[model samples]
Target: MRAVRPGSARDRPATPTVPGLLAARASADPSGVALTVHDIGSLTFEEWARRSDAAALGLIDRGLRPGDRVGLVFGENEWIDYAIAYCAAQKAGGVAVPLPAALPAGELRRLLAHSSAACLVHGEGRNPPHTGLWTATLAELRPGAGSLDDVRVRPGDAAQILYTSGTTGEPKGVVASHANLTFGCTADPRRRPLAHSRHFLHAFPIGTNAAQTMLVNALDARPGALTLPRFTAARFARLIEAYRVGTVFVVPSMAIELLNAGVREKYDLSSVLLLGSTAAALAPSVAMALTAAFPRATIVNYYTSTEAAPAQTTMVFDPARPDSVGRPASGGSLMISDGEGPVPPGTPGEVWLRSPAEPRGYDRDGDAPGKVFRDGWVRMGDIGHLDEDGYLYLLDRESDIVKSGAFKISTLRVEAALHEHPAVADVAVFGVPHPVMGSAVAAAVVRRSEVSTVELRAFLTGRLAGHELPTRWLVLPSLPKNTAGKVLKRELRTLLATPEGDDAAHSS
Candidate 1:
């Protein structure tokens, strides 16, 4: 409800435990504003540490023991409170599980049951019906009369359990250790891009992987972290000018919206020195547009997944190789393999990466044996290739690649080509059932203005091969997107299956 700006509080902690990190920050600069949720309120380092400490006491008071899982059900309004609960869980030697607030009731119930969560801590009015789990509000996690004892936590101890987005299948919980959660916490702030910014801006939802990364960036990278519970193109642009945001983190979808909204022309974004896009591949066209919008800023496209973090690719947009997602980061290794062994240079295959920060594996209840994890490497489930120089270039999700009669087409390549058209605002290329071809290329296009499918196909003639062009097309005002800004291709397939929208599909 209120915004408070505190003076410089410079305290850096070198602890590996989540609570130890907070304790160090609080001790260094207790009055520093650590987290800010737009239109809500903020928490100073001291306030965050104290409240979380009390919450830890409460967890202990409620019989939470080491390795116990505590599920968190909070939305944007409860970010600060969620942070407190997160630390409290770690301090009490418990594992914190952040549940997506937008999940359906059935899915939520399933996740809680699957996670074996001992206690559920939620925001005000955000609690769900429980058959057996203990439930409490963030405010209810109060300290008892007795002094709270510090629970010892090891670097190898499990600190958090993050569920996958389940785009391909059921969501599996990935267990991260304290060392994984605390990676880069002790890095020199003066050298990092975020350290120079007074305010860092991001709009990732609370329970997603990107949001967790932003939370760490808040504690280590920048002085204050600003967030938008809901994302809108205009609002995000204005926030930069309003707060003079120096560092920003976004996904490809948000970047596209900003370019299309033309908000950069309406706002003074000169304060922004660094803009980073992640969680999905950055379309080359969108990358170019970002560079134009923030001429004075360094635009970076980072490539990483929840299962393979710390080991990531960071690219500072070069015109020569705009599509490349950069090389393997320091102390990390990446390779492309075709199930048997490493593939030749420039061959597309599953992207496998090994990073010290990677989780040991998924929860025992989840599948991690030989499919996702094998030979000490995490299969990214992404289709990509490495250049002769070893830079990674992501094509598309292996699941979304279109398969025609005799050819496999990279949907991302087609989508990227479509984006180059002036009349096309957005596009998603996928596969659909065909009478003869078994599967044919189908595209869902969002145009800037009324345009005929015939005209669009003619435009892409030179850019894509004849077979790569869409045989079926649907022109919609916008593509269906999830909370994380990823297009829901499954829904698109379902939409095409219905005859009601059949008339909208145009053939080349």
Candidate 2:
């Protein structure tokens, strides 16, 4: 297949639909590399567009209708197929529901049932859950001489339903319109986002908000997108060297692992021009280490949620205000409220972000949307205060604060102090039941070198208040994390609640 030369086409899609984005890119540069999964194959814009069109035709033949939900279950190694299937769903005017391969069978069933998906499209060599829905493999979607010209997909039509990581509760399906997914896309390659790089890389798992953003980046950004089947500091570093990748995206957990494993010293990572951390706030210490590791790269931390996509705060790591997550980005607005109304700077309150793109919400019935979405703003469920200069500083998740007697301790503050220790590799702080204090602070720490709880407490004695220091400690091999890389504090709470001297009890 030959690629069309850039600037050869003058007519571009007027509306930014998912299928429209691909059509525009293919028309502009059909031969340009669109996506690559390392050690796996890649597809050019032309191949992606053609194959997805064929698959869309197959879906239409199988009785898929506009507004029908199609569940897409794909394995990590099947990104190429996943991309085609995703586009095909949109092209066929169906709502795509992407699910990660690592999801448990029961949870997968729950999501498919919740979405009321009409069919399931799965990758090769995988067993889709027994959902009683019509199912087919990617290979079964054969290419054919067919056209989707009659399909009536619109920018405002529902395009996909993505489930959250369920860090706090059962995952909620988030609905995004074609416009929401393709917001800010540009037809001009020279003016496209992330134009500084030839290629950008990430290891975010599929079925996540971060991964969905990467998919949109693949569709809208100037650079070709790259990912690995799995993430390890070694392989991630090697890809940077191999591709000389300019822009890299990661979560705080990945950044911590890279620093702990000393991958920066072992690999040539200077090719990275911009390093972005998302999913969770980067601990100040970790952010500083990343800056030192990627000496030439601008370390940026992005703050947003599933409901607040395309609306986030971008911080280019500033040592003076290391804890800030930056101000509301262009086309977005940030406000801190104390339930009744907006609060003054330096006063911690619930965080709300207003989206520049169309608002997204829980794809369920009843009061769910009202609980999180109000007017056009999304409740971030986080407690933070803005500095006088307008930079936002997160104190803790509303659910993560430890209530000890009369004091409300920020778990983030404790974790940040613990991270300052030379021997501390990683740490998570949460509240555990205490008859006297109601909830006492408990800490689970992963050590790089031998370090006692007594030492850790001593280290925090000056850095934290007496009530803020952890009374219970557990030295852990590693912190538990969901696929999205957010620490599973609920699991840690269960572990900490175990009786002392029990086989499973590591608490001191």
Candidate 3:
């Protein structure tokens, strides 16, 4: 092991404070056009700063306490508004909680309830429905008088609590401190382009990890960079073509949609220099597809949980060795351990990381926030193993794996097989109960049209090891997906909790 050089951090120039982050960008090139939104609008560093200051002053004067949670709700095409809210929250020493615009009233209410949010600064019409129980819209919230000057924030303080996509039940507030944001970003050598780069796109929502990463990148490298109001495959292509976007980041789902949407060829995207992918594992095929689309750009695959430090691992694409998630960045250490013991090379185990940055822990009781790490390392709930070369290869989730008799099965393997089926769109696999087989592999598949379990089973027979194949296949119009597009296998397991849950239940 390299024992992670503390010297590597020193090699980089002294990083400035959070406020300096924005100011440095403004000072570097005020009219440099920090941000651009194709067909929407653009913002200079001066404009972004002015709005940030206004929102900060507004948030402070509006009685927002330091560390208070301010819900920043924006509709599509309001990236500037979201940025304003984020900077303002930082200025006021408060945290910005970005809520997805698509969530319904009930789900929105649950988010507010869970967040214990006392104040909200939201755009009109963009406020999540039924959030009135707690959230307040921004336009309607007039400054209460003089609340600034009192909202100074320290480097170690948390800047936000980005909620997970709520694919399971509720989202957990993965915490990130200001320094954590700064350190995590600059540590990754991958961001060297961002050090003194051109304007980048923040097309995704402010609430998502992608947006958060973009925010830090903006503040750290080129301040006042532009971001799209929202992300759409067509709009993404247009933005890149028009703005000469140097970097474009998105999930495989969006990338696939863009490819299939026929817009990829419609735009002159030569300006796209880096294609960054994160959130969930991008199918290897999707990685290949991205390389094919952005021939001029470097395809970077980043791995981090809402719970871990950003860019903990990153792999720039090389078709010859395309599967790695890159080496650990300068800030953290990564290892695969069996909870108590270290695993051998190529053996899948839980991915654990240790970062000087990242939340010490979460606020479990709504007070006295706690750190979630043990000793120094944090448990990242992902199941992957390091190869002899230190490249990480992901297996299915440890809990999501299906154990049938003596063989342990990979749910992802089965899902990948189902995805290859002509009629299947998406699917979730699990192990329920079995008297004889110990546990039987079960599947819930979302199909395109009339498809039967027998047909699906027949489809998988030769493709999957007989024991690895799902015993039964149930068809549905769609499988449940959380905001981040992760499948809610936990929900499926509960819903199918009966032998019905295990149509492939062990032969009693």
TM-scores across all candidates?
0.94, 0.95, 0.80
Each candidate: RMSD to true structure? 6.3, 5.9, 5.5
lDDT of 3 at 85: 72
lDDT of each: 0.82, 0.87, 0.66
Q: Which candidate tops TM-score?
A: 2
Off by over 4 Å in 3: 1-17, 37-39, 126-151, 184-192, 195-199, 223-230, 262-270, 320-322, 358-360, 365-372, 417-439, 442-463, 474-479, 490-508
Write out the backbone clash pairs for model 2: 3-31
| lDDT string, candidate 2, 46-89, tens digits | 99999999899999888889899999999778899999999999
Sort all candidates by lDDT, best to worst. Answer: 2, 1, 3
Model 1 C-alpha lDDT per residue in residues 1-508, reported as the tens digit of each score: 1111110112223436677777777887789899888899988999988888889988898889888999988887678888889888888889999987888878887888888899899889864865378889978887776345657777767888888888777788878777777766764445544666888999988778898888777666546889877889999999999999899899998898888898878999998999999988788888998888998899999888877776788888998998899987767789899987799889989998877453446775544336666544678988899999999998878888877788888898999999888888888889988888778888899988778999889989999999899888988878998777888888788887888768777777
Clashing pairs in 1: 1-40
Candidate 3: C-alpha RMSD after superposition: 5.5
